[model samples]
Target: WLIKNYDYDLIKFLQWTCATPMKLIGKQLTIIDEQDMICLENDYSQCQPSQNSSIIK
Candidate 1:
């Protein structure tokens, strides 16, 4: 709820919380684009909006 309501950068949050710790142990981290990000629930929900796609905000 905080994430959706706050002016926070999701990508930065992932990098700091997930990627940074893994990199310290020599793990390769790939940065994904915003367009590739999707919020799913039970592998069926899509939360990102696209112009050419059918996903609605």
Candidate 2:
């Protein structure tokens, strides 16, 4: 939804996802964008939980 709604690049998104800090709450994942203007939230009910929780940008 972030990529589609914000027109974010795939490579950049992947890199950002790799480097940026994130927060997880149960099945929800939250991360700030590079511009620091948006917060992306993803549901990971079908996947494993993430390990890192650093703030982005």
Candidate 3:
């Protein structure tokens, strides 16, 4: 909405957002708080599960 609702002066806003952390899809998220710092964190399960071939035996 920022791009559409705002005028041509939003260039800075766009730049700042690029620096901030971003929330990823599927149990992962990275975001920056009001303090303007980068924060990265995600659920342990978000990582791709490893296959256990031994269990198939």
Specify the highest-TM-score model's number. Answer: 2
lDDT, candidate 2, 6-39, per-residue tens: 6555545564455333332232223444454233
lDDT order of candidates, top first: 2, 1, 3
Cα-lDDT of candidate 2: 0.44
TM-score of each: 0.22, 0.23, 0.20
Off by over 4 Å in 2: 1-8, 21-57
The C-alpha lDDT values of all candidates are 0.39, 0.44, 0.38
How accurate locally is residue 52 in candidate 2, as Cα lDDT from 0 to 100? 75
Q: Residue by residue across 1-57, what tens digits does model 1's lDDT show? A: 656776456554553342233213333334543433343343233222223445458
lDDT, residue 30, model 2 = 33
RMSD of each: 13.2, 10.9, 13.3
> What order do you get sorting by TM-score, best first?
2, 1, 3
The Cα RMSD of model 2 versus the native structure comes to 10.9
Misplaced by over 4 Å in model 1 are 1-10, 15-30, 43-57
